[model samples]
Target: MNDTPGWASPGSAPSDGPDGKGQDSTGQNGDAQGAAPQDAVGQGPQWSKEQPPPAQWSAPSGSPGSSGSSGPGQTPPPPPPAPGQGWGGQAPGQGGWGQGPGGPGYGGWGAPPQGGGWGQGGWGGPPAAAKPGVIPLRPLGVGEILDGAVSTMRTYWRTVLGISLTVAVVTELLVVLLQGFFLNDSATTAALDDPDATPREVLNALGGLFIGTGVVLVVTLLGTIIATALLTTVTSRAVLGTSVTTGEAWRDARPQVLRLLGLTLLLPLIVAAVVFVGTVPGILVAVLGSSDGGIALAIIGGIAGFVVAIWLMIRFSLASPALMLEKQTIRKAMGRSSKLVRGSWWRVFGIQILATIITNIVSSIILIPFTFIAAAISGDGVGLLDSTGDSGWAFLIISGLGSVIGSTLTFPITAGVTVLLYIDQRIRREALDLELARAAGLQGYGTAPGATPGG
Candidate 1:
């Protein structure tokens, strides 16, 4: 062997006896070769330095000691990743992106989200049909109603506040004028205020009071009818995520104003009729035949009438919106409102009551301070309700300013809540969310030109 291999160095030999020197033409470790003698059953090299070491952070997978190998010298393929985790083979404590923290089985550290994407489920889906206008195109919660209403006012402050301020100023001005002219400080009025006044004097004073009251009622009613009709148009458009000018609102609402006025007048008349019908018998009994039975009947009838009137009001709460939005006639609007409110009486009632309370509470909070301020500014010489209250210009201006501010704030809140409630009821019962969403330009809401209001 030494004679035949004289041309080559021993270091480059393919096979060699254990040389103390670590030299090799083929890639094989000197330690591994020296430690074990190989038979002719295998290839030259079993392990290579070029191959990577097994990933430690990646948990090992195999039989007890087999390591998924066929024999003692064989290496196995890696196991598949566990479910609900990333496929990255990164080791633990590595904060690199695209890899699960703590290994392939955990989802921490911005691993690819495992949940299904948008439109797969109802929650956390795409905002295709979410709120796009003053309200969302779905069933609403109490907070959403309040929020939506406020949103409408904020969105269309120019139109909404303008309408409110105009109406309120006109109203307050009319009241002051009526008081100054028709309700002048008459000495005879003092006699009527006396408890022991004569019948004739009392009747005269009562007649004058009734006339002034009628004038005030008429002015307030006319103003409300106009304001509500115009505002309803604006609210309807607002729900569809559309803006409208006062002129446009008026143009759209002009046709409905008379009808709305009729409806408003009719409702109060109906309530009056109901109260009259319920209490007339009791009144007659008390007047014609004074008895405990008569008193009880009057009390019972009054309570029952009050309850019925409230029910009617709640039942018809949606009529104004229906009429303005749907262009429905008075009777149809009433029918539509009744239909919408059929199964949701208490909900509508509670929401209406709450909105009214919130509106009034906020208004009172604003107006009360102004009232006290006005009285103080007037040097305590004028009470707000006192007929002989001096024309302290500063006091009048401050009080009117307060009224304006309160009206401006309250008007939008009440109007928005009422409109949103109508929309909500329709969404619950008639799939109106789809219509609203489409109108608001949502993509998947069918024939979508737009989407519902959120602002």
Candidate 2:
């Protein structure tokens, strides 16, 4: 049989009984060997010389079989069962669940098949797949992937949460400090709030805001890259039911961190370039004199570019885990991701978007209360929408605390989902479950003793 379950060789499968020719051969063989009278004569006196009365050999007169014609002293076969009735003797429609018309009813298992079926283990179904850790070693469904991620977090809270917390605290601390030092200026906040402010004032205020944002973005990006790298190791180990320490995860992930970072940075740049290329032509046309045409063309091009970018983004989403787990180069990792995601683009995209939406909603649920509390504590009274208001040190710290908490909780989820998705894709396309089973030291898996799993 193949490595996959549920497929069996024809000779190994269950059969109804001996074929018609085999039955004929058996009957002929028995006739040629002579009936009981010949054996009785040869055995002398051990067997009865005279047969019983003919009436005793025939079926009972009132029985269903008695009506059928048969030779003297030969029993007639019983009549066929009524419609809907099967081997279980229950009427066809009277059977409970799983009772097909003119077939066995629910829980009405008949005699075992000729080869071997009903008497074997597990109701004659295929063996259950092995489960080494948070997930079963087989192709996963969407719900199973999500549950595996959550299960990993729950099962290995120490490693997963430790990594997420450290990253979140450091990232949020930097954001708070940067904002306090650079973006808390009363002048900029006042100018931004003023409706009568000139374009120059607004631009200057916006410039400060953008700079602060850029710094935070860089810091956050670094934190995310680090967190994703470490968590990839943790999740992979979890798949094999192996526990890893934060230090061990770090060691495992450290070698490929640079490659992961490059991948993380490269994807966005690629997407941005696609978008930029699309809009540039329109911008040029607009500047060249045909403003309306240029605007229309640019919009169309931008839309098309955005669609392509999204496709590429989903296509390469699994690259990070591939790079981390497989120690693949950036280009090869991207290629691996593309190959795994081929023929499953929509499924991958849907899963990714669902995870993102869930994490974002959870983060928002956690962060919103902190935002209000920060506003209230800082004497701002819920000016969350009014970005012009300069947030005090108190507000920044409180909000940063919220950000830290939110990130700490959400980081594991996002990272786990991505890693699990990568594993799921590989299992579906490349039979990765076999390798995972072998790595997990499971018995009775793979092709043979010490045999390596195939792709």
Candidate 3:
């Protein structure tokens, strides 16, 4: 009789148990590998080879044990080799430890062969190596991604919040400076009316505007890059419970800034180019046609331009994150983002649109009053009381103040969501949760010997 915990009686065929392992009738080798032979009652043969052998045992062809047919009076043949070895006396399959066809170890039913176990194929077959920091694409609920985003924020709130505020302040300052000099009513009115103004005067004014705007723009751009890089670095480290200094974050960010900037500029440029092309025909028709025809053509062109712009934006929405986090080039990152986001454009679009609306609404609430107060205090209100006096300067100052306030309020939300969305998508597509869990020091993560994180 088999003495194993889950084995069956002697003379019975092997039966599959709940765990998918086989059981012998004699209740012998019920352990994962199988049981040993028992002594015979009458001593005709100490052990009958005809009885079903342990799970590992194999018998030669034409042998009673190999035939799997037992008779009441017949003596059984000797058992075969151990369970993992095949009848040919070879290991089930070949590959490095934990590197197999199904991935690493025995996988689910019908699952492709993994690495690191018997019966698994080699690397030349399917990919069996599990990698770190990569995840598989799967359907994810909105709440789940949101939860992850919130978790990320909690983990890296210091860096994310600080950088966001810094970027917001810098951006606000730039906007204020630009509005103060160029977007003022005095500048606009003067430019429009001074048709005979000296070219030098016009050039000087334009130069001031351009130089000021350019300087501010450069600062804003740098701030944005710094904010995004720091946020990504902090979030990733926090999720892993690892500490990273600002210097380390900058190091990681500096190398990818060019690619990120290229991607950023390219996406908008492509959209603008498409919109320009779409509108060109309409513009041409409007210039050379009757009023009604021109209006119709212009309307049609505008609609087409809007649709194409939306489509292009959706196609490349995830590129920024891919470029920054994966250290990929602009083209490759765009391609990777496009591939990963396949069939999920609408979801991403909805999230982005919602975030935009929310940020805008919040900013409006805070800035609207500030604008009114600034305009009232800046002498602009005097124009409303007395039409003879020009309040253009006052209007400029008021607008600048409002702009500064608005940008300051809105920057954090915008930057935070953008970075968070990128991380969320990666988690959904790459089984990033498991990788992150392992990184965060969770037990059982990468605990399996030879198991890689991203595989």
Candidate 4:
């Protein structure tokens, strides 16, 4: 029976576990070639006849502090050779490497391979180093997940930032133009706090507010779909140790754009529907009975709706990555995400929440100074401390630039984490580490020319 722990794929070599620490760091020799045996050109370890056999092991024979049949001053004898091996085999350290077995008479990891790790009698030695990629092909911990996301940004900044900045700049410029030239923000501001405002003024302000909100929502939705689709592709390639260009990402993700848009639209509408559904009973109560009772019902309904929204949001949080990466239908993508999230709702929720909080904090730190600068540069007769409804394009443009820059900086991180989080969940549940390793071109991660471990 296989003995590797829960976090690692079965029959895989010793490596890092979920805690992001290597299983064995004692510096053992790699396979007979001074590297880990590769099951494929770009994957993690897999067992086959072409690879070395498992290490040889035996139980301890002597009692503690007692040398069997020899005097106390004498050393114990070396363990027997592997089964069917001649007694004249090379001794420990003769062929170099091999920490001399993890225990007495256990001679697999350290033994010299007779066939360079694939021969009839040899066994595997130390595993090779994981190939450089967005992440190592193993179970990931929190730190590893965070690092993988950042590494993609650092490694492919040109592509990632290009996509984000392009989307950001377009949205930014458009928002500024609309706010400055089209919307009457001063009237809206006056209508908001001034109770004596005429009905026409208030109605006009409401109309402007609705238009601005609708436009903002439309642009934000478009930007998010584009960003998520392209970044998901980029991050997937990065996991395979491949670099992607913005154009390549765009082309690859183009097929899924409409589907992604549908999903993006559907999710929010679902949340809104849930919240609206909760409010219906309260509305009915107000119409049929007391206002006070309706108020209480409404508050309770809103609270319940909030809890359900958070639950559904977390449950389907991974759908976008799955949709892009798996090329699944919208319904299938949601099913896949929900399946992955079934047993580990709390863990995924916590990580998603944590990533969002960190991203927001970093963005706020970047945007605060830009806000001050925008206020200082306003020239439309609005004071620095006053609302910017009357301010000229200078304030709108400057403040919007800050938002663009902030989004550019923060977008990759948020998108990358979501992708990596999806992968991590699969690794934990479906032995996806092996596939990732193979995809990453690790030596020992897939089927070879002989018997497989699974077989």
Full-model lDDT for every candidate: 0.67, 0.75, 0.55, 0.70
TM-score to native of every candidate shown? 0.70, 0.74, 0.57, 0.71
- Candidate 1 — what's its lDDT? 0.67
Any runs in candidate 4 off by more than 4 Å, and if so which?
A: 1-129, 198-204, 379-389, 446-455
How would you encode candidate 4's per-residue C-alpha lDDT over 1-455 as one tens digit per residue? Answer: 33232122222332223552211223231122123223233353233444322222222434232222134433233333332222223343344323222232223433333332332333443233254587866567788888888999999999889999999898878777777777746756678678898898888878878888788878877987888899999999998889988888999999999999999999998899888888888888988988899988988998899789889989999999998999998999999999999998998998898899988998898889887887776643454434445766667767887899889988898999999999988877887767766666667553432322211
The better-scoring model by TM-score among 1 and 3 is 1
lDDT of candidate model 4 versus the reference: 0.70
Give residue 102's lDDT in candidate 2 (0 to 100). 19
Most accurate candidate by lDDT: 2
Give me candidate 3's TM-score against the actual structure.
Answer: 0.57
Residue range with the least summed lDDT across 10 consecutive positions in model 1: 5-14
lDDT by residue for model 3 over 22-86, one digit each (tens)? 32333232221222222223432344435653444333323222123244323233333344542
TM-score of 4: 0.71
For all candidates, what are the clash counts? 13, 1, 43, 21
**Tens digit of per-residue lDDT, candidate 2, span 1-455:** 35333343333432223432111122342232223335345433343446554445554433222222346534433222333433222344432222111122212332322333322322365444678999988778899999999999999999899999999998988888778777678887677889999999999989987887788888999999999999999999999999999999999999999998899899999999999898899999999999999999899999989999999999999999999999999999999999999999999999999999999999999999998987877884445433434787778888888899999989999999999999988887788988788899997786532233333
Instruction: Give the per-residue lDDT of model 1 (tens digit) for 360-428.
Output: 999899999998887777675555544353445546567777877887788778877888899888888
Which candidate leads in TM-score? 2
RMSD of 4: 14.3
